[model samples]
Target: MAAALELFGARDPDDISIDDVAAAAGASRALVYHYFSGKRELYVAALRSAAAGLERRPPPAGGAGSLDALAGALARYFDFAEEHAAGFTALLRGGGAGRCGEVGKIVEGVRGELFASLTRRLPVREPGALLRVTLGSWIAIVESAALDWLEHRDVERRALERLLVDQMVATLTAAARHDPEASHVLHNLKNDR
Candidate 1:
């Protein structure tokens, strides 16, 4: 599964055959079939496994008290992407629209965890909407950056990661400050100023 994910970031769940995965894993194709019914099921299982691994590897502690947790989480996210490029790519790129079905649910599970982590550190009252916008934008940027890094290995990963994080923080902070729920607070601060 890891090998297959490494090979194709995220193609049609049905497109990836048991034989393909077996070839990648150096296992008998029969064994692969014996374990999994088809590509969709296997892909879902792979996603679950990946999510589990990521959850087990906790992000660094200590950033929670300082609002620096966002930076730390972004750093950790980039590090994870760099180290497990294939798996991370697969997780980010896979599945279809709506997240209603099995595969979609798994994808949503992964995305939900990321959104929760990001919003937990922020003061946003409408966390759901804010998290959606923030995560969607972040994903787009990271995906583009990842592809660029793939093509041009000369670019520094740390530099790109820091830039992404900085931009995300600025955007989220501004949005939080402007949120209607915080309007009173902002108005008070403005008057004080």
Candidate 2:
């Protein structure tokens, strides 16, 4: 799996083959087959392993249910991308068709976790609708920013990450302030001031 990840980082996922991985791992092709049904499965496994590693890392401390938490999550995501560029690309591309079913599940699990986290921080009148829009928009922005960073390697990754995090925090904070449930919370803060 590590060999596969290294190869994936060096080339496109479709260009990688079981033979390549097996040779790199010094394992028999049959052994690779025994573990993975096909190349797609192996690729998904590599990506899943990487994603699980990222998931296990704790979110930043302080402001557990606030925009700070969201920023921390985004920072973690960017850090993962920066460190494991190939693994991140494989994980993102594995969502396409003709891939392992488990890949979809992994993507769904991450999306669900992110949505749940954002939803918990949100004070929405219609939680479901608000969550859908907020999470979708947030993901779109982050994905776009990451892709942009990938295309321009010379760009400052940390600055780009901070810019995205700032945008997300500002957008979510504004939305929450207007939300009926959050309005009271905002009102209390203003009163306390």
Best by lDDT: 2
> Scored by CA lDDT, what does every candidate get?
0.62, 0.68
| TM-score of each model, paired residue for residue | 0.71, 0.76
| Model 2, span 112-143: residue lDDT tens | 76666556554443454443565578777887
lDDT of 1 by residue, 1-193 (tens): 6776665564554456678789989999898889888666677677667766666567656544233455566667666767676666566655432242665566677667766665554445444564466556776776677656754678787777778766765555566565653343223323331
TM-score of 2: 0.76
Off by over 4 Å in 2: 95-101, 122-128, 173-193
Clashing pairs in 2: none
- Count of backbone clashes, every candidate in sequence: 0, 0
The top-ranked prediction according to TM-score is 2
RMSD after Cα superposition, model 1: 5.3
Task: List runs of model 1 lying over 4 Å from the truth.
Answer: 10-16, 65-67, 95-100, 123-154, 180-193
